[model samples]
Target chain A: MAGGGAAASALSTPWRSLLQRALDGNAHLKHSTFFQLATVGGGGRPANRTVVFRGFQEQSDKIQINTDARSNKIGEIRNCSFGEICWYFTDTWEQFRISGFIDVVDGSNPEPVKLQLRERAWFGSSVKSRLQYLGPCPGLPIPDDDLIKDAHLDPSAGPVDAFCLLVLDPEKFSYRNANAIPWMLSWPSILVCYVNVKAGGAGLLEINYGQAMNAAFKRWLVEVNRKTGPPPQVANGRLHIA
Target chain B: MAGGGAAASALSTPWRSLLQRALDGNAHLKHSTFFQLATVGGGGRPANRTVVFRGFQEQSDKIQINTDARSNKIGEIRNCSFGEICWYFTDTWEQFRISGFIDVVDGSNPEPVKLQLRERAWFGSSVKSRLQYLGPCPGLPIPDDDLIKDAHLDPSAGPVDAFCLLVLDPEKFSYRNANAIPWMLSWPSILVCYVNVKAGGAGLLEINYGQAMNAAFKRWLVEVNRKTGPPPQVANGRLHIA
Candidate 1:
């Protein structure tokens, strides 16, 4: 029965594909509130913050987001490209967590592709101001503080040294969905994509039964289990995000 | 002038003593809405999650909180008795991120400590119940589903196993405060207690400047930076959660 169920799910990829399409069509991503981004650095420790999804391209697995070049994250990502990105859809009780390496793209390059990105940036800024304020300057009137000027000033020009473009290429992806069974259980079952970064980007995807998903959901779980040559640990409880 | 600033912030025995008092004081610890608890399995990676502080004991460095026994965190600590605990205070932009191992005290044991903790739990539950849910539990039922009754019931038995008790014993600690000056420069500093977990739990507390504090703060900054990583690479920037 389990095998048949698995096969049925596999064959129903068109439905899943359509669902994915609908999710991508979601207007929330354009509003910069749909995704959470985390970066790991300073000797491989992980740190996370939220970011907006600026844009996505299907043909090339690359994402584009902007940041201050002077922000500590630029240094962290330069040191270690591996980081985790999470997208939570509350309406659907669904979360997608992706881990990948990032590369900073140069926005000023005059190449055709780069030009296209620059044009998109102009449109992006027009739609929503992408400037960040560095807190109000003291002594100066709050209105007098040139926050936007400081944020968008060219890094090479010495005032806004933090402005830069960030590009991320995900290697691993995991999807979790909350399942509600009448009078039985209300918890999420997860489907994980374990990308073998060193293996030419081949992914091992697994659908987890709720109880057995905890350790498997963790990044270190697979490594530790393999090294120790033991069956994975499984526990029951809902996972909470802080 | 620099030496004067360093000297002012230096940890004299009296200053250390005062900081310790603040840590122990119920009013100081309970002032914060959230506190971070970090735990590690023996030879395993560290895990951190925020938990509401129930209270603290000045004499024993004992802290109390509620947790589900089924949590993977409980299992992690079950194997490894030592861990770190950190409490953050954002109002003053001051934080005390402490490091310590935990000892799970037996609640059923007839120790005076157990009685005190039970009383606190009773009081805490009363307060927690009144607070509206912290975050939207999307897809949560308006009326929670009750557990199905067992065919055979014991009259004398109480409520089925639900909540569990957790007690933390802190060992090492770090204190951080944000300092901003006029113009465009600001630096956040930290005093970290590098606990010696290996050699009988004795170690030096070092004051790391510039890079170290930035690194510590980077953990909190990652989420913000992610808001800025590249745009989503997936087509339509969405993941189908199933």
Candidate 2:
């Protein structure tokens, strides 16, 4: 709530709501050309990777991504919770940078929050008919019809033990326009969001925006949350989303 | 050198020359959409970034790129010398991954390498002008002379101060095709380059039909080096490309 006073003042604007809507209602959100995640490694130097965003949390200021637990990224997050997420919106000529903490969740965990993730896994398996490999590899040998049928005998096969959820709890957020005027370019009007990490805790802070813009953004955030439901929880250092 | 033994036994084909030409003659070498550099950072976590290849050194296995010295990537190289460069050829559905070590050079230093970097910087700045900024204030006074100029001017400005040479002493290289196989769905054979960084700076150990398909790609890498020249060195941890 440190920046709440400033945020409250900006929340009086309608433009904020429009900006928020533009972010959530935009169909091309999933088509970001380059998405980067920066995390502190155990050796303490910052590490980051480009990943596809699976979904967004408008109300909670959260973002969701899917990854294999066996990947190096998971190990980095496990070592350090503080990290940054950057999404380049080429269509809009803008860059959205979010810095926050992350928690990993498993698909088979008993937590109710994980139900949606399990469903997504099932859907993913059905659509692809095989788990995608991360890097280049030799072709998979074709299985006989019976072998193929046998593999699909159980829907659980869809949930590879490697699949996991990565939930980002944003603490600071900024949207930068790279095409802005040269002189006025260094710092554009940015909106920053800070989150309280305690269980069931929520706080919103807006940074450097006019009243109309903040209000518009808040409305959009609320709407996005309503659509996505509550923020998922971290059990055993993993996020479980319903 | 360890992987070189296996490479020699792979195959020898007339297509080797084709692959070599593709690497050395492409005009669009630097502008490829998917160019990535992977370097080891603190704690040994690998870091990768998309970069525009400025040049390559077939003789030394050195690849040069213009970068900001102040960027966090500088810290990454300071911690580890080994790195990997990966290029994704979307048109061909092929990927080339090169692993090597890097060496930073100073542009302002009295070395031939530094002089070459300065020449490139001069060439870049000659055709361009500095970009001026407009006020951030909405109704602030506007300057009549403030206008956008050519982009090439000082393209090396930030990069010179931030840039350093990334000499990839190749330890190993791999070419993989990520496409459906002929007849049945299978992956094409992989062409692995197990280079002895010190023994064969740049020479063909073996080649076959699979590598012939990558002719255009090899030419692209060499083209990058031809155009970019060399990386400026680091003097007291700073680049003097200007």
Candidate 3:
């Protein structure tokens, strides 16, 4: 019955509250919005880089990120939409690991709604930002070591063909606060318990469960069920972070 | 000839200089050494977390990280040694992405030299740091919501069975500085050129070439060769960050 209740609740609201609190606490710092995004690169290796968080998608919980369509990440998302984002807030000494599926909305996306969202995001972007798409394709060697000149894109120009808006629909979330308890959450069925013994500045242990809810995750679920024989409190309907 | 020269030179010295400069510039900040490590998880999705850099291995370029053998990363590395580390310096506004293979040295490892390295690292660790290994298996839920009691591991004891030393043998490195030009390096053969246009506090373009040196990387090499007809200066073995 507790498992059924957890499944019924689906998304965890308490985790969201905690994340919002961290965000609000560190909103004054510009770098607070910067986070590392890791994706499966060619040959199944991990590729990670910093990405700026564009606020949540209009009226929805999905995280928004504006990126160039010509970047390698676009191809990476095409091959495998699964991605993980790690964000650390310096002021609060808090860290968040969010794993999810990234939905790429580029010019070629068939969905009209996604295209409209892309257009709206493009209009919201400054002209200086839009001019980047007009430059040579990213990652290509500039011929003859020439410096890039500024482009003359109009301020009112629509979103360029290379503009893409990525929407990350989160499935699993993990939060760690140096001053408080660490909490983890997953949608529908999966749940994880994690502890990091940070005696010095270094973290001693960390575990990640991707949204697919792989074998280890399933095993963890069974283990939690077996260990907590008396019906876990959070497992019953309400999500708790304490 | 330039390609051969680059191959002969192997590791780029200029990139190392830049990294050392960043390290020296940010040595006062404790979190300067904290970086995000990304690895492939179950179902080939990306897993990322913050890890403290233990410094370069003894007389080697390999990055050192102290971890628990019982952690999920040990298993992840066993499954696939390929991993990437992204280090960002807040004060300097610089970022480094190092891609490489991880060499796991656990209690089960038979190599005496590596074992000695592990022992030396253990001796270097603080007593409070060593006590983490004595705690319950990480990521496993505690039965009945019980808190973890302090572990009383001896300061002079040898490395525990769960203590592991991860040596990341870097094959490719990318560096970005907000105040200067971005540079990239690869060992012996591969070379990558990347440019990120930052506008309004957001990076518009970035690229990653994993160490396996996949197809896209091969094509980039050819493109560089064809474009720079007069033979690139850096390709002539002298590592140049400019």
Candidate 4:
């Protein structure tokens, strides 16, 4: 584990716990690991594709995703780092929409911890998966003889130049207030934090329970907010149910 | 069916057959109907979510997708009509990336044919699915009592104000040349065409089969292009395998 994501680690744990709960609940389904990732493409149009979630980076809230350096997404991220991940847990009937800036950690990155993370990601991948990167550039036409080149590949070698790791540092999490509150109400939810890591990780935890709730529920939200500590920061969009 | 999309009906049939084959092959899986739609949001950032495909509009290539008028996606589409759909067929191991401009047809749309399409989409939806629009505004805080309002709703009524039908008029279809060519090889593939409907349906069908494929494949592409009976117009990016 690297400390590069220490700033993002300050994000409140309740949302992480909710996500973990969903992951645990849907552990039986292999499809649970896949999520849709959206990126701003050329001409500022939107491009989206399904991607496998590797996991959270180290212990931070930042999401880790593996992509080929030669892929269109790599170019898309280079042009614009803004991205969003929409993950739906079928068993829990919960959808997490995380919008953030992605930090591309490739061979060009200077940070030692990031390089280590990249190495770890490389070593963690199966040999079959790693060999795909050694083939011709993705999305391009394949050469006449690709099979002959595979025999010379070394499985134990470090990640090739094409292996790139994307760390999405979440800036905001929006909850469809109605859908989120029902699940959190069971936990007597109060805290609604918007972790703005882009602000140098000064976590802005806002406890906003709208006036729509009943008097008793409002009182509980206030009571829980007082007990949670740290004053509310600048307001952002949407209620992030904890 | 309404004939508003008659102009786009000029798209060649081979590509349609390929997509049809994938759909027919994966008809057993319910998840096969769901695809990822990406739209350019505010600040030109990409926003993506899983959307159910309602199939092509009548006999044309235009994709029909039902959405709520109150949804952020509706607003995003209004801001910039450029959108892209990436659909992966698990059974066939095929991915289709179609980029186009979306036409939003709500109560405000004056076109009679478009209105008929909307009505058809509304009537096609399940009663339970249609009832959701009758509820509180989505993404907003729900009031204390919502269940009481559901009993008085008329399920058979015409589409509510929130219900909207989106017609994506595809301009370009991209293929990961390597992945697409292998599958299309079985069909003795030829003719990669880009249909540009944005030119008021002048239908710029560009036959651009790249030189990356072998000589036999190149000859096949030329023969197919000649048989298709139209001159290639306007160069575009990425191969569109047929």
Cα shift from native, residue A12, model 3 (Å): 7.4
Docking class of 2: incorrect
iRMS, model 1 (angstroms):
11.3
Ranked candidates, highest lDDT first: 3, 4, 2, 1
Candidate 3: deviation at residue A230, Å?
18
Return the clash pairs for model 3, or none: none
For model 2, how does the per-residue alpha-carbon lDDT over A126-241 read when each residue is reduced to its tens digit?
A: 33333432112112111222222233335454455556777776655544443331111011344332222233332222233321233433444344344444344323432222
Greater-DockQ candidate between 1 and 3: 3
**Cα lDDT tens digits for candidate 4, A1-242:** 22123323554565665566566667776667777788988788888776778878766788888888878799999899889887766545456677789999999899999999999888876766676666554422222234334525576788888889999987656432113222112223443533322323233222233213334334533443444433333324333332
lDDT of 2 by residue, B1-242 (tens): 11122222432322222223334333343334335565654444444455545444423334555454444466787786665565544333344555556666545456886656545543443222222212222111112222212322344444333234445554455443333211111113534221111221222222222333244334432343344433332124221211
Listed models, DockQ each? 0.05, 0.06, 0.35, 0.30
True A-B contacts kept by model 3: 0.60
In candidate 3, the second chain superimposes onto the true chain B with a TM-score of 0.69
Evaluate residue B181 in candidate 4 and report its C-alpha lDDT on the 0 to 100 scale. Answer: 26
Give lDDT tens digits, candidate 1, residues B1-242. 11112222434332243343334333443334345455542234434444556555433445566665445566777776655454433333334544445655434446876656654454455432312122122111112212211423343332222244577654444443322111111223433322121223222222232324444233323332243332222124221111
Clashes of 1: 22
Write candidate 3's Cα lDDT for A1-242 as tens digits. Answer: 11122222334354555566566667787777789999999888888988878766655557778898888788988898999998988876778988899999999889999999999888876665676576555423332333343456667767878788999998877765553323333435534433232332212112243435345445644554454342233455444433
DockQ of 1: 0.05
Better of 2 and 4 by lDDT: 4
- Model 1, position B184: C-alpha lDDT score: 13
The DockQ leader among the candidates is 3
TM-score of each: 0.41, 0.49, 0.73, 0.69
